[model samples]
Target chain A: MPSSSSSSAPTPAAPSKMYADDVSVVVVLLDANPFFWSSAASPLPFSSFLSHVLPFLNSVLLMNQMNQLVVIATGRNYCDYIYDSSAPTNRKTGNGKMTALSCDLVAKLEEFVVKDEKLGKGESNGAVMSSLLSGSLSMALCFIQRIFRSGTFHPHPRILCLHGSPDGPEQYVAIMNAIFSAQRSMVPIDSCYIGALNSAFLQQASYITGGVYLKPQLMDGLLQYLTTVFATDLHSRAFLQLPKSVGVDFRASCFCHKKTIDMGYICSVCISIFCKHHKKCLTCGSVFGQAQSDAASETNKRKTIRT
Target chain B: MPEVRIVARNFMDMVASLPAMKLDQLYQNAFICQAIVRSLPPLAKKYVIQMLYVEEVVPGKLIEEWVLPDGSTKYRVAIDRLVQLRIFSETFDRTSGTSYRLNPTFRVNLQKHITIGGVLPREPMSATITVRLPSLEDLEVYAHEQWECFLLQLINSAQSERMTNISPAMMRIFQRGLLTQREKDAPRLTESGFQFLLMDTNAQLWYIIREYILNSEELDIDSADLIAFLLELSFHATGEAYNMNTLDEIQRITIKDLADLGLVKLQQGRKDSWFIPTKLATNLSVSLTDSSARKEGFIVVETNFRMYAYSTSKLHCEILRLFSRIEYQLPNLIVGAITKESLYSAFENGITAEQIVSFLQQNAHPRVAERIPSVPENVTDQIRLWEADLNRVEMTPAHFYDEFPSRDVFEAACDFARECGGLLWEDSKKMRLAVKTEVHMQMREHLRGQR
Candidate 1:
């Protein structure tokens, strides 16, 4: 139903007009969170991870000559566009474009990781930091928007988040904003959580955007999971059996405490969540008294029941 | 649209039609394997990639479980296509049930292509030797001009302004399907040729390419090698000049033929010669179903049925003349209208209304292409109605049986013909019945048996 609504909305540049000829544009958000991958408990090494990912990238390009790929490395505090297939290459390498692309991607990713590590060392001694997923998502959305605006033919654009980092509770609002933007644009946000635990934020993002979200049981078979589940273009996904979402965690993080809560007090004017009652809304600065709060809570209770 | 679909299938179908040994041999080349994978159905491509590294045979049930219940139709189609192309080798076992494993050659080659990467046979020539080479835009223009010239030669050799130096061998390829010649008359466009003219450029290119490959044996060329080279050529960067000396004997000849089709542009320097692949050459490996890969549309059709084409090429004018009356032409634009008489003429030439309408829609100007119906509904409807007017009367070849010995015999014959689903007409009073020509022999035998 979301697909139908998004397609029928008459958006200026809707990617919903997918023909067999239309090429897929996948924006890959690679989690370069050094803290997560370098941890002793991590199942796959960073080097082996690249070995798996490079083939997956090649396979995506091999699926269609015109299929476009954009790789973004999401580090602790920043995300950078590392490799773009559409970027014109001036160097005439003896090898094919596929080889050139893989080489460039690995080089760029190494450079990004080195810079991020240096920055992280300066900022915090050895503290764990969440991958800048929200920033990467926003960047991916912006890049897709630019492609849509400069349209010759509308390409099917989707964001592929390959990360193991757990969700950052503080960045809840920004991540949700990116999710809704992706939903509105009908760009599925497929998430392949390579981490040890399930990412609730990504689960909700994939659920909302009608994308496949999978956490492979065996980390060694990451390439298989990516090729079988994530490599499928939007049009072909209609016929494939993708991993189904059992249930989404709809819990909201309170605006004040930045702690995720199942049952929360809603701000009357701004709809901001709070762990406890407040006289004024923190988000919109709208004043609310006891009666107004009671009414808002009553409506929120009904909405919760309906959902 | 059906013609377009046929064109899409022609190249892959040719690949599928190859003998198994040759196909396996062809798969030895990593680029050809990659090309085959690229041309697979979307679901099939996923299956190949999923099983690329897995050495064990997968149960058919496991692959089936990958699709939803509603997607079983697609699942079957995907599996069938894979099997047809020999990408998946199926085996039946008593205990394991049916299982499939990737073809070893295809898997190994594709894996190498993905992991180690494929190297082109020839590297692009240095800029110093190929000084003052054409820019990408110039190469595109040259390719377009060459293709237009070739098509014009197809339409009418004498009418083409430039002497199309297409070799007799190339002309022979077109002759087999598109053109027909009388004893002493100039070769003329056949029914399919007229329809071919209306097809999108990519489809037309595929048709010609398929014909060329089909006729490769006559030229003592192995089609598998030809296909491998063609697919490899597509992997090369467009407008980059590759040294001709690096090619083998068969490839050198094939490149010459491809140059004639404007797939690649040939360039000569003071010391050496090389071939620069144009967009057409680069598009060769692109799956035929990728209609968007074709050039941008240029024809704009209004509700009034007036047409405007913004192409300077004479080929566009000739193709438009097939289905519309060209009122006038400017340096860069042509004005035309779809009239009843022109439609009739087109229909007579075996061009269908749907073909004309689809041609308009496919080549619609970018300004109107975004609309829901690229071609106006009224115009399409009128075109269909005009075609229907020509097809109002039904014609059938039948054998009339009369003067039967008795009413019962005639009634029995009528029932027999009706049962066969070939009864064209029957009249119990006259004791006469007409059966389709195909059923006449059966009817005669049935009557004798009755006797």
Candidate 2:
């Protein structure tokens, strides 16, 4: 019999290596900044954007029976988890209804957006606000860590950030910190930029964490871009030819002026970047002599020239 | 450290082996298509989704370019699997070296499934109609008990306390390959039955389900309809009660049979009756390679060959007794030891050393499961040695020929047997030779013709 023959083969004298199961837990960080979507320059409207995103989320869950999903809405000032497929409360409503996940996701997102809009009612005077991308990334990482600790089997966890808002230079340090943490945890951060300009923050995030960073040329095919490029799990990414990143913007924003610069004076004590020479570092309050500032600027100029 | 590997014939393999027409028919349902997509290899799934919206036939070289040079093997496997399942239809033309187009039905249905998901065929009955539905935990216990009772019935029909509920038809499915019955004696475990007992729960569950589906044809049921319904049933949320009025005649009967197997728990309320899917039913669509579906380990084996199983179930005790000697039993623990005599008897019953080692590893307590070798190395080695001892001697049937008039005839006969690839042994001095029973007739005819 097949069973007897298979069992007769000499068994390996070691624990079977654990294969990376096809299952994955995708934590989607969706940019929900109303200011970005409400602007006339935005390519995709909020409603149609959701129309594309809902199906993509459903596709991720449908890819594998054990695959999990978590959707966190990144608002201008705060971020909150909108939906989790593995949560017991979500499963209870999932019952025989196939669209339960989509329904729940949309309703919760609408509620969150309304509340966020109410808080920002006075600030909607044509001023663009950046979505809390850094906070959302940190939240996604924490959620992944919790899943890893709570279960014996670890599903391949990843973060997919779908944001169209422009980057806020003030949040550079926090975003970089989140990026490094994600890198350390081996979680890839996939970024899908739906805005006219490519997001420099997300480009670096994806590059550092070994994930796909795509800015689709046409926003009309957002769903196609999502399913084709961002739907792949980490395990399968090695085999598929994902869109290659052209280049990453590694320039750091200066703490003094919040301006991104290719070459800058960095405070040795706190590693804070500055566009111009400063006797006193604003960040760590460390003092520097004239000679030190002159020498640092000379080296910075040489480094920029060589590059 | 000896890994236990059960040759689980997963549902996908069965689906892949289906005839082309049947496969197309199976893919007609959106849920089945989704399940098929779920069961694909990771690369294959990516290919399907990437091609879900593309209407044109993609060149083979273009698909090949998607993988790195090192991933050629994976790429080949993915393409082969997709073609075998008919999810990707391969075409060849002189102009375009080779190309593949997604199966129209599969593409359309899967696109619909992803873009616009559909609800299950049946909806859950309202709380008022199906009052006091069992909790998820209770449903799990019910499913476990029912499955265990069914397996116990297989081991020994009289050993199961609740054998009365198992119909003769259901029992017949279990008897086909696992048991044999004599004219005047009760049914006995066959060689395969011993191996079946050593399989983990998920493998065993799949085995029975496969048998049930395979046997459905004899009962005048369309196997295709049964498969679709079963896969759809897996999509139902566990512990939720679905109204029975939604099912057709065949489904109604199938649901009853499934209840006996503990896939679903049948409940009756004041004026309505509904069935609640248990974890088992909900896990049906999950591929067998997914080890996460396995229950947590409960058996802890020490290096000294002593075992402590923290399970109170009688089924656990009975299964343990198959290859180990039971010392004593506590309310929540079963103490056992792996001994030579017990292992020898187990080997005699056709259970292999690997199965025993794997059974132990699979059931190792969560505390020790993290260890490299869940079961002690010495115990696994000794069990393997004992099994090797039984395999030391092998018996083969042969026909011995002697008393040949001349060495020439004997030499010719030897050459003839050798050429036929059935020569067992030969004695040059005595002009005697032994040929395999299968080739004896040919050898005898050749010798007679030479004379």
Number of the top-ranking candidate, with TM-score as the measure: 2
Q: TM-score each candidate.
A: 0.88, 0.90
lDDT of 2 by residue, A1-307 (tens): 0010011211111212343457678999999988889887589789899888988898888888788899999998789999998788773433343467777888898899888878776774646467889899999999988976976666668899999999988887788888877776778888998887778899888887778889988778888899988887776775667798897776677778877777777666666777887779887789865555676756743233101
- Candidate 1 docking band: acceptable
- Evaluating just chain A, the predictions reach TM-scores of 0.87, 0.86
Colliding pairs, model 2: none
Tens digits of lDDT, candidate 1, B183-273:
7977666677877776666778888888888788787888888888888888898888888888988888888878887999888877778
User: What DockQ does each listed candidate score?
Assistant: 0.45, 0.37
What is the TM-score of candidate 2? 0.90
Q: After aligning candidate 1 to the native by TM-score, how far in Å is the CA of A26 from where it should be?
A: 0.8
Model 1 clash number: 0
lDDT of 1 by residue, A154-252 (tens): 677989999888778888888888887887888888898877767888987887787878888887888888898888887777666778887666666
